[model samples]
Target: MGFADYPFTSRYQTIDGHRLHYIDEGQGPTLLFLHGNPTSSYLWRNVIKPLRDRYRCVAPDLIGFGRSDKPELDYRFLTHYHYIREFVAALDLKDVTLVLHDWGGPIGFRLAQQEPRRVARLCFMETFPFTFDWEEFPLAARPLFFAFRRQRLSYWLLQRHNLFVDLVLRLSTFRPLPRSVMAAYRAPFPDARSRYPIRVFPGELPINDRDTEAHRAIEEIERGLAGMPQPMLLLHFHPGAVLGRSRVAWLAQRLPDLEVVDGGRGLHYVPEDRPERIAEALEDWLRRRLPEPVRGALPAARVAAEDDRFGGALTWTFADTEHGGMVAAWSSHGLVMLSFAEDVDDGRAQLARRFPKASLEAADQGAIANLLAAPAATPLHLVGTPFQRAVWRALLEIPPGQTRHYGELAHALRSQARAVGSAVGSNRIALLVPCHRVVPRAGGLGGYHWGVARKKALLAAEGVKEP
Candidate 1:
């Protein structure tokens, strides 16, 4: 869907009682676009319209920017993190492909680490997750910060008395933004009152040692980014404030797998200046990195458990007295069988007989097992083909906290919507694998091998909006 064609939506959520504004468009592999300081989802306007044909694009204004409510909230790292977590939870997006820039680096990186298996890949530009190690600020950046600190001075200096947006557009691009495009960027904050976020953003930068709290979060994000094995593609602009050969080299040394794109002589806003190149890079990376399709049967001993956390205790018992806690058995290679038993120990013994070499571990901090013991959620193992496995891996990329529909999944898989449904039904490690988050094309709860009621409960508990 085109930018204009997609309507903006708002929802009143309990988190801070803020009305979060977001745009959800198209169908396919989810592309979560996150904006940084002084800008909103509108920064993605030029890029999203082109990529939406092949991917679902969901972009939201950070709590204090764009059409979202700007309350007297603490504008700290943790606060932004909470909003982002709630935003995705409310929508129930999964298997997410994150597109980050500037401040988005830390925000999106934290979310990825929170649920590593849920993120498929990452694409970021002009961003840094490091702290204390940042290169010296550029001379041009100095003026910007100067303007930022002298809020009163900047207010009168800029003819319109709103230099934040003007500076963003001017310094953001190597080439001047088109007149119309520049106008659109400034449209969100028409007056000084609406520009509080912009005025306060620079002061939020953790530039020195005294800014401990924000710097600590930055350090945490840097450590997480360093350890992430997920494919990361960095699109960097040359000769920009945040981009340079030395910084690029540093990142390369840190994230050896990271791919860096040097937009020769381009400005910080690489997405706007080189949209097609960015799109091509993303498409190529996805094709090369996505795992090859493999057909297989669900292992019999592997049970599907659902809960808020994966490492929790079992909440229900599928085994009887004879086979305690053992719900299914599977061949080492593929096929598995499901059995209901009265005895938990007998179930374990039965599963051991089926696959002596298979290991058992609680999923997601014992959350799944806890849910299984209480029967508070659905538990089922899915069996399917190699094509289905590829489909399942794609499903895992949805960020821990987001959801998508069957049609969107199909588009991401480059298959028919019906085929996507069939594959989704075959998922075996539900909750841990997160197939429960995928819904129907009409935005309703879809089928679940365990039961539809369980699916609804899980989605509702996760804060997903249901039709």
Candidate 2:
């Protein structure tokens, strides 16, 4: 039900006698992310992580998808739409900005058309607003999808073998996905019955009026789009499956306040290939086009309360160290914060900066000493973006007395050196996270939070020779 990369609180709502799972994080204007078939809320994990800091990001595992309950109902287009509408109603989510992908495009657009005022904006990718003709579809993908339309064949491929989770997803992305990520996508559909929803989804594709109900639904959504006045963002990419260049142009002509951005190199699964790019584009759009909603949606007091929900009561103390005085803070969860400082007062001040929302209390001096003595063994209550957490996890893998350059760490994470360096800079638990082990690839020690001298000293103590 959970993955390390998707480190968010799981929330559920009872909708039509079924339990629908979702991840609701941060506060302010709502960003309701709707996923498509063969994927779930897990698809938006990386995309949601950074945006959650500024926006109320809510992504639900649609009924029969991800961790949601799989009722034996007809998993049809209207069925999904009905459940999503009810789910939104249960949460009383108003002034929502829809983030749509794949089948989510049609479902979300229908919601906006039906309840235009409730939805403030729309952002979508790899999703189409209308049904497609056979000729319009990607040539290479047509045969596979055509076969999926056959009930018996689709059952065997999608249900028994799990084709989408196993093969299609890997092919749809520009780069190969990590094994852990693929595992998360496969976790929900472990058996034939569990994958029924996935099998039904392909059949629901409204191609050339084949699926009358879905076709009509999509046409209705399309016809009403030009009249809808919400601001929209279209993240288009090359070699698209559902939404190609022509579709982007079609959307631009319809959406009055549309802002289109090239979401970099990606295929059907844009989120997997370029989550950072997608997040940056969406964030920029929000900041520039809808600053009022982004900043002024929630009351200041309410915002503070929601943000401080974690690390409720942090106990902190100063631990004397050879290099300098060290500050340490811990919550019931684990060690929350640790840093190098000048003195006891300086240590306390540093802890205040780290855990501003936390109600600070004096911890046992002995416990703080024990933590300093063996920090690697202490469990860390690390707070960071998924990318930052990934980098920190890799950092922990580096043995003591060893060092890795920024490029090497970046290569391991399948990220750029600059991005990895940014994550390294944001490390909270200093010595334990081992950011000091990361040096400049060219030669010498790079920048450190405490000081270069302190970094060199820490590295030397770990038996790492200065380059």
Candidate 3:
């Protein structure tokens, strides 16, 4: 499809004296699409067109790519991060749903973390922000790595021979890209000299803590994500035969709220193969995360009456009532504060302490108890930092019967196994949310809030065939 035929309205904005190219279309809630290395807003062409009518889609070509200006400034993390912040500010976007892929993860993630209230949800695909050890890099990337480190030599070769754009397009995909797509990607690099950022990107990958330029920026972004509570969706692509699926699984475990979708192309560029899926996932998440308008306010008495029913043992009695489910109750008060006891007296005392002034009474709310006793079909709400939220959201997407290791979830969350485990442990609503489904790398039952026995029982109940 030709670029002109697309439904988007093209425009440019001046951010910090540089002209930045962007596409805005549709008219409902706002959706910001951030591009990764060697690609521009054009990467989201397919996504924008389909979603325009229902959403206001804004995809910006990072400062150096597409129609944006290629200034002679250092193309470091801070520079890009500042440019994105300026671009969003210039446009005055609010309550945005961010779609990030590849390097877009850090760029978009930083923006969300900086202004958490403005970002309702996030959709991450085939990207990482935590850390990627060089040992995990694919064999094909070794040459690219070596070329990047030899900055002077690499720049000379890429710019002199006009190989940067061509090589990127060629190696970015497992399947061959069409002539038109190739043209679109390479169109920005009219000459080798204009491809400085392309050369700089690979060189900037933090191989160690010594690379303070990019490493510190990434670490800061990781810290931000660890605490963000916005809902996150993780698209776990196949890393490659060498990396294995375990890495992605590790990410899911650490991120208590992640909703991982399968069938992505690979680590290099998932956007090229599954742009629509990523866009749709973002759309759905936006709908869920953004608060809806209350339809006609209820009278205080009515609200109080309802609260009263849910106040004490009365809450147990209404367990099966319209809004009296245990999950619903915990969802409102937060899981950390809710308590359950073996005896009625103990439970009553706990409830009194938990909700001091709220009335306390008891009734047999069997249905709510049953619901909690059963495996959850509804996904759990994982509360944590933005990165942890992203990781947890990815975890939620792991199919009900399937299990992934801590390391696999880490790779998907773009963090480490240890970080993933910490997030998993932070998961509030346990059984109903299914944090129990996550296991260890060695195929043993990992830790669970309720207990390992309960975790195993829940997993078995969900039809997980124990090995």
Please give each candidate's TM-score.
0.63, 0.62, 0.62
> What lDDT tens digits, residue by residue, belong to model 3 across residues 1-467?
55323445669999878899999888877889988778898888887777888888899988888889998888877788899888888887766778887678888888877876556567777666666676776677677667766868777767666565677656766767777778888888888768887777766775662566787788787666546655567766676322246766765655544566664566466667666666676666555544432212122211121111234322422233222222222333222222224445555555454445455344445645555555343323233344444555666577878888889977765456776787777664444445777888887897986577766776787799763
Task: Enumerate clash totals for all models, in the order shown.
Answer: 67, 0, 42
Q: Which segments of candidate 2 are over 4 A away from where they belong?
A: 1-4, 209-211, 291-467
- Give lDDT per model, in order: 0.63, 0.80, 0.64
Worst 10 residues of 3 by lDDT: 299-308
Candidate 3 stretches with Cα past 4 Å from truth are 1-7, 239-244, 297-467
Ranking by lDDT: 2, 3, 1
Candidate 2 residue-wise lDDT, 106-138, digit = tens: 999999889764676789999988877888888
lDDT for model 1 comes to 0.63
Error of 3 at 332 (Å): 23
